[model samples]
Target: MQLNQRINAFVELGKLLKDLAENETIAQTILAKAEAENGWFTRENILFSLNNWAEALTQANLLQWMSKYNVELLPQESNEVKKVAIIMAGNIPLVGFHDFLSVLMTGNKVITKLSSNDKTLLPFIAAQLIEIEPRFKDYVAFTEGKLEHFDMVIATGSNNTARYFEYYFGKYPNIIRKNRNSVAILNGTETEAELKLLADDIFVYFGLGCRNVSKLYVPEGYNFEAFFKAMYHWKEIIHNHKYINNYDYNKAVYLMDSFPLLDNEFMLLKEDKGFSSPISVVFFEKYDSEESLKKEVSKHSENIQCIVSKIGIDNEIRFGETQFPKLWDYADGVDTVAFLLDS
Candidate 1:
């Protein structure tokens, strides 16, 4: 298929997702299946993902995003298609959709190994795309076995599994992503509205995505009162059994270890230098100045995915908008489209 045809198919798929997000009956049924398969795929989180993608897949957004690249120069016919094998991560719903979209938009075929925890959603999406354009039926695939006959590979996993991916797919052109977390740089002057939005950044998807803010850099003597109060916006999230279980367990362990912790009944805040915090916990560190903090952030830039702040730092994502990444916001700052086009 041509690039325009591929783009049109995805735009139509986006509209279908928008309609599904609105149709509560269909959405609930899909959510039921998702939840049954993975307890972390809560209805709220899945819908949040769907709504974001729906907004992202507009024709204008696609064309504007594509305009940055010369995708038309890539091969269009099926015979010339480059096969891209994608190993998806299941931490959040549809985490691999962007890579999937990039491969197809570059006129490549995809051989996906679906994460067991996310088995239901992307396949359903692929089925919809195939329905919209019959040609996509040839471009999309899912395999529970060994991947073979692919020109390139894109994989996402933990630092441990990434090593395995490298050992195996190292010879092939690939994009293998490892564990990375988001951090927020906070000044004492943030407005209540912004703090409330930051709650969504931390709590949406239950802090499961790479985009979720798991760490914080706050000015010295930063009072926790306003931050804690703002976090109450997601108090209902505590009702999730799996979340409460984590909170209880982590709180108990920290108490036993005599670690200093700030607790607000649901989430735990610990003064930590670490980037990746456990579920129901957010790590925090005190910074003396933006210059020092920026240096520190740069030192560990490889471990961070998004930096949420309005502190005049470079490439910082605004508060609460970390999850709403645009089509061009490539994960790991690696351009998947460019990789595919060059492949």
Candidate 2:
């Protein structure tokens, strides 16, 4: 198919996913399965995750290929298609979904090894995709096997796990995921509405995903009051999740032992020298120049995923997204589109 045709196919797949969201019966069924099978993931979490994936894989994300690659797709020469192996991450909801879309949209077969933490959602979505368009089944496979058979690989995991992926999959062309996180830039200009949504960006998912904002680059003397006020309603939210609850439990003991924190009901604001990227914990820094901030951020660029603020002449940005990563935002900076096309 032509590149435009492939792009249209991706658009169709995105709509199919959105359709899945509005279909209440299927939604409930999938949510139940996702909860039962995913263990600890709630129904609302599953639905929200599915919806996020549906939104990200839109034409806007796919069009990124046109500009990024600077090439158009060629018509298929034969029915034979490449087979790509995807090693998915379970960090956030449906983290592997992007690879699935990359493989399917590129008219390639996907031999997927689902993350043990997220085994349920991908398989369920694959089954649904077959039902929505049976022909897609021929182009996909969910499996666990030796990596030699696949033409290329896209793997997501920790920096340590990435080293292992490199050792094993290095024989072939591959995309290996390493540790990464997102940061938020607050210039003290955000309105109430923006702060509210931005807080959701930081706290939602318990700051677990790579896209979760784990650090804030704020202007000097920026009032924490505005941020705290916008997030006041979520005060009761801190101790709700098991993971966050454990964090708070430990933090309380640490504080009793003389660990310092800027007190607030929803989250603890502590002065820090670094970023954790996947916790309610966030490191804060005040910057005078965009050059200096980007210089500081550049040192940890490999560890940062998205920047959730506007960019300026002195500012720089990377990773293509803030909290919501579309089909093109390959996890851990792996370029699945390039790998797929080359394979």
Candidate 3:
């Protein structure tokens, strides 16, 4: 299929996903299956992620994203269709959708090794796409066992697993992503509304995705009163047994160790220099100077994903916008579309 045909099929699939949100009966059924497979895949979180994808898949958005590349030449330049193998990370629902979309958008075949945690949602959506345009049947495949016979690869996993990916797939052209966490820089001037929105950046998808802000860089004398008060918006998140269990466990461990912690009966804020915090906690550190903070952040740029700030930091992602990334917001700053097209 041509690029436009592929884009049209996805556009139709987007409509189906958006419509599914309105059809509570169908949406609930899908959510139930996802929850059964993974306890972290709560109905609300799945629906939130689905809605974001639906909104992003518009014709105008797809066309605009494609306009950045010489997409029309894909079919003309290559006689052999490259079979791209994708190892998806299931930290959040449909986490690997972007890679899947990139492969097919470039007129290449995709063979996905689905994560056991997120096995249901993507396949169901892929089925819907095939129904929208049957030509996808020739391009899409999912394997339950070891992957073989692929021309290129795209893999996402923790830093440990990334080493294995590089060791094994190093011979092939690939984009391998490791662990990354987002952080927010608070200058102590944010309004309550902005802080409330920041709550979504921290709590949405239960803070499983890399884009979720797991750390904060606050002014040296910043007070926790306002930040804690604004975090009340996601108090309902504590009601989830899985989340509460982590919160209780982490809180107990910290208390036992006599580590300083700020608790709000739901989330815990700890003074830490780390990027990846425990699920029920957010790590934070105080900064005395903008120059030092910028230098420090730049030093760890490899481990940082999104910098949630409105303080004029270069390439900073605004509050509540990290999770709503557009089609072209490639993870790890690696251009998936360019990678696929070049491969």
Q: What is the lDDT of residue 189 in candidate 2?
A: 78
Residue 128 of model 1 has an lDDT of 88
TM per candidate comes to 0.98, 0.85, 0.98
Candidate 3's residue-wise lDDT over 1-343, tens digit each?
A: 7778888999998888898766747767778999999999988788887888899999999999999998555755445688999999999999999999988988888999999999999999999999999989988999999999999999999999999999999999999999999999999899999999899999998898999999999998899899999999899999999999999999999999999999999999999999999998999999998889999999999999999998788779888898999898989899998887776
True lDDT of residue 293, candidate 1: 91
Quote model 3's TM-score: 0.98
Cα lDDT of model 1 by residue, 60-96, tens digit? 9999999999856688565777889999999999999
Q: How many pairs of residues collide in each model?
A: 0, 0, 0
Q: Which candidate leads in lDDT?
A: 1
Taking the tens digit of each residue's C-alpha lDDT, what string does model 2 give over 215-304? Answer: 888877778999888767656566556656656775686589886765565576666657773245667778887678777877877777
Q: Report RMSD (Å) for each prediction in the order shown.
A: 1.0, 3.4, 1.1
TM-score (C-alpha) between model 2 and the true structure? 0.85
Candidate 2: how large is its RMSD?
Answer: 3.4
- The TM-score ranking, best first, is 1, 3, 2
